[model samples]
Target: MSKLGIKDIAARSGVSPATVSRTLRNPELVNKDTRKKVMKAVRESGYTPNRFGSSLRTQQSGNIVVMMPDITNQVNAGIIRAIEVEAQKTGYSVLLGDTQGQEARERHYAQMVSSGQADGILLYTHRLPFDLDNLTANLPPLVNGNESIEVEGLNKVMVDNVQGAKDGVNHLVALGHRRIAAVLGDNNAPSNRERLQGFQQALQQAGIEPDEQYLVQGDYTTESGMKAMEALLKLRKRPTAVFCFNDDMAIGAMSVLREYGYAIPGDISIMGFDDIRYASLMNPPLTTIHQPLEEIGQASMRLLLAQLSGKNSAPQHIQLPLQLVVRQSTGPAPESD
Candidate 1:
C-alpha cells in the first residue's frame, strides 16, 4: 500500500493497463460499460492521476500560454476572457503572459512552451518573441491572435486592420473632410503600418493628397493622443476631422478638444478604432471600427487545440469581419471661421 498506480486500477476493474490508460487519457475511445467500470474502480481506489508525470511522459501539458504585449489595454480583456472560457471547455488551462512590449519577457514566455510547461502559445505581439530558426527544430503549437505578424507556418486569427481603418477613414472622407488628421499607434508596429496605409489609401481614392503635417505618431495611449491633438491644433490649417488608432487615444483627443472650447463634430469631428465599451458612453458617442475581439480570441484557442490534437497538418488563418460604427462623434466637416 505504498502508492496506487494505473495497474492497481486496471486489476481492480479486470481490464488491461492500456485500457485503463486509454480510459483516463481519452474516455471517448473506450466503450460505455468499460468506461463506467474503469471510472468506478478509479473512484473506489481514490487514485488521482499524476498530471505532471503524465505530461512528462506524453510531452503534453494541457496548458497554453497566451502572451499579450499590453495587458492594461482594455481591448485585450475581451480576447483574454474568450480564450480562457474556450480553453476551460476543452479541459485545458490558460497561462497569461504580459510581455509589455519587452523582447526578453516575450522570449521567456515562449521558452515555457518549449520546456513542456505549456503545450502551445497564443501571441498578441506584432512579432514572435523567439527566433524562427530555433522554433523550427521543434515547433511547439503557436497561434497569432488579434495582431497579424506574417510567419511562414503560423496560424493567425484577426480582423483585417487595413480594411477596418480604411472604412473608418472613408466615413470621414464621405463627409467632405479633405484635411483629416491621424493619430497613429506605434509607428514601427505592423498593425499601425497597415492602418496608416489604409488611411492614406482612403484619402488618395478621394483625390486628396495626405498632408504630412496632419500625421502624428502615437503610442496607442491616451496621453499620446492628447499631445498629438495639441500639435495638430497649433497647425495653421487645422484638420476638420481626426482619426485615432484606438479608442483610448480618441477619447484623450476628445478631452483635449473640449478643454480648448471646441465642440465635437461641430468644430472638428473625431473617430477611432476598436469599439471599446467606453466608446458609446462618451459625451457625444464615438464613431469607430468594430472588431469581433471575442471571436478572434476563441478562434485562436481553437486553432491551437487542433494543432495539439494533430487535427491540422498545415497552418490555418482566419480573418474576422469589421464594420464602421457611426456614432455622434463623427459628422460633416465644419465650416471655416
Candidate 2:
C-alpha cells in the first residue's frame, strides 16, 4: 500500500487538511470535538509527520547540548546518564560538550545555540559558555545543573552545598574531633565558598576556633589534594580529621596519609563531599556527603523542556536535598600524641 499522508488523515476525519495542520501545530487552536476526530483518524491512519519539515516550520532541532566542565570526572557520569534518559523520553537527543574548564571550548559550544544546532543548553558549570551581554536580545533557554548561578534569566537545579558541608563537619565534631581540617576547592567558586561557610559555622558551634593553618587550598583535583595533604602533614598539630571538598581530592589525600604511616580513621579520620561511585568501594569506605546527581540532571532537563514547550516563564531555582553517608573512613578522634 502507498504511504499515508496528512491529506488522507484529513479525508478520513471529515475535516480540511488545514485543520489537521493546525491541530498538529497547536492543539489548543482546535475545538475539542474536532481535535478528538482528528486524533482518532491520526491513530487509525498511522501518519507520522516529516520531522525535517516540522523542524523547518518550528525552528527547533530537538537537540539539547549538555556542557560539562570535566567530562572524565565520575561525578558527572550519573548526572549525564539521567539527562540522556529524560531527553530520550521526550523525543530529544543530547550533545555532550566537554568544556574541560577551557573558556574557548565553552564559547564554541555556546555558538550552537545561535546556529540552530541545539534547541536548549544544560550547563554543569557555574558560568555561561557565551557572552549574552554582547547581544541586546534575550538568550536561549538555559538550565543549570548542580552549579547555581544567579544570572538575570536562567534556571538552576542544585543541592544545598552550605548545609551539606555543615553536616559533614558536624559529624566529625560529634566524633570528638576538635582539630579538623578542610581541603577546599577554588576560592572563586560559589559552591566552594558556601561549603567553607558551613565548615566555619560547624567549628564555631562546637567551640573550636578555625585555624588558618588547617585550611588548604585545592582545585578539586587529585594532585591539588596530594599537595594540600603534604602541607597539612607538616603542621605541628596535624588535624585529627580532614574534610575534602570532593571525593577525588579525599582519595588523593588518603594516599598521602597512608604514605605518612597514618591509618584512616585510626590515626586520622577522613570525610569527603559529593560521594561518587568509588566512595563506597574505597579501602575503608569513604564517609561523605551525597549530592543528588541524578535528580539534579532530571530536573534540569525538565526545566528546559518546559521552556521549549512555551510553558516556562520567570526564573526558577530548585535546591535538592543532601545526605551524609557515614562509613568506616570516619571514627572518633584518636588519643592526643
Candidate 3:
C-alpha cells in the first residue's frame, strides 16, 4: 500500500484520487463494483508494494530473516509457511535461520541481519541473540514472535500463555479433579514460565494447595514428556489429572500412560497446550489449548512491515486469543486418585 502512487491508479481506473485512496485504504467504504475496478487496474499495473523504503544506508536485499528455535517443530513449520506466503504478497522473501536452541547459532543469525544481508527480522526467541552491549548498535528492524523478550521498544506477538494454561487446568478442576499435575516445558521460555504461573493460580483459586512435587519439567520434546510422566508415576500419590505445556509433550505423556496400563480420562485425564495438527489425531484425541500459529506468523510480518514503511515508530505488543479445545482426553475425574 506504500510507495505506489495513488494518482496513477486513479487515472487508469477513471476514478477520482480520493476514490482511489478510499478504495485502497478502506475498500469496504466503496461499492463493490468500484472496488473491483480499482483492483483490476492495480493488477494490470502489476504492482506489489515495496516493504521497505530507502531509510537505511545499506542496499536492500529484498529478504527478511526469521530466526526460530527449531525448524522441524510442527508449530514452527506452520508459522514459517504462513510467513513466506505473507511476505511474497508484499514483494519480499524470507531467509529462514533455524537456531536449534544453540546460542552460537542464534548469534550467527543475529550477525547476518545486522550486516545488511536482510531488510529486517522476525525473531521467535525468548531473548535477543546478540550481546546486550550491542543493543543500541546497528541492527535491522525487528519484531518478536511466539515468545517475548524483555527488551524495551521491541514489537511482540504471542498468545496469553498464562490465561490459556489457567483455562486448561480449570477445565480439569471443574470435572472434579482434586489432585492435578503439570508437565512444564523449558522454563527458559517466557511462555513456559507464564504457563506455570497460570497452573499455580488455577489451583489456588480452586482451594487446592500448591504442591511442589506435582510439578515436573520437560524440554518441549516427546522424550522429555515421557520422562516427566515416568517421574510423576513414581510418586506415592500420583496425580489424577495432568496438564502438559505443549502438544508434543502431551503425546509423549499419553504414550507413557498407555504403557503403564492406564485408561485415559477413565483412570486419569490429560490436557495440553498448542493444539497442533496431531492433537486431534491421537487415540482418544487431545484436549488442549489452541494457539493461532498462522496468525502469529502473519501478524509478525505485518508488524515489521509497519516499521519498515515508517507508519509506526512505537513498539506494539499483540496478545492473540486462545481457545480451549475439548476432546475425549479430558473427562470427569474418577472417584479415587
Whole-model lDDT, model 1? 0.89
lDDT of model 1 at position 115: 87
> Which residue pairs collide, candidate 3?
none
Candidate 1 off by > 4 Å:
1-19, 26-34, 41-47, 132-138
Q: 1-337 in candidate 3: lDDT tens per residue?
A: 4555667788889999778767866899999999999899889887543334332523777789999989899999989999999999997889989998889988888887667777788999888887788674544689998788888778889889889998998899999998999999998999999999999998999999999989998989999999999999999998999999999999999999999999999987988899999999998899999989889999999998888877756789999989999999999999863
Q: How would the candidate models be sorted by TM-score, starting from the highest?
A: 1, 2, 3
- Of candidate 2, the 10-residue stretch with the lowest lDDT total is 129-138
Position 281, candidate 1: lDDT: 99
Q: After superposing candidate 2 on the true structure, give the runs of residues whose Cα lies further than 4 Å from its correct spot.
A: 1-51, 132-137
Between prediction 2 and prediction 3, the one with superior lDDT is: 2
lDDT of each: 0.89, 0.89, 0.88
Q: Estimate each model's TM-score.
A: 0.91, 0.86, 0.82
Residue 97 of model 2: what lDDT?
A: 91
lDDT of 2: 0.89
- Name the 10 consecutive residues with the lowest summed lDDT in model 3: 49-58
Query: What is the per-residue lDDT of model 1 for residues 78-174, given as tens digits with 9 covering 90 to 100?
Result: 8988999999999999998999889999999999987889989999988888787766556678998777887778888877888988898889989
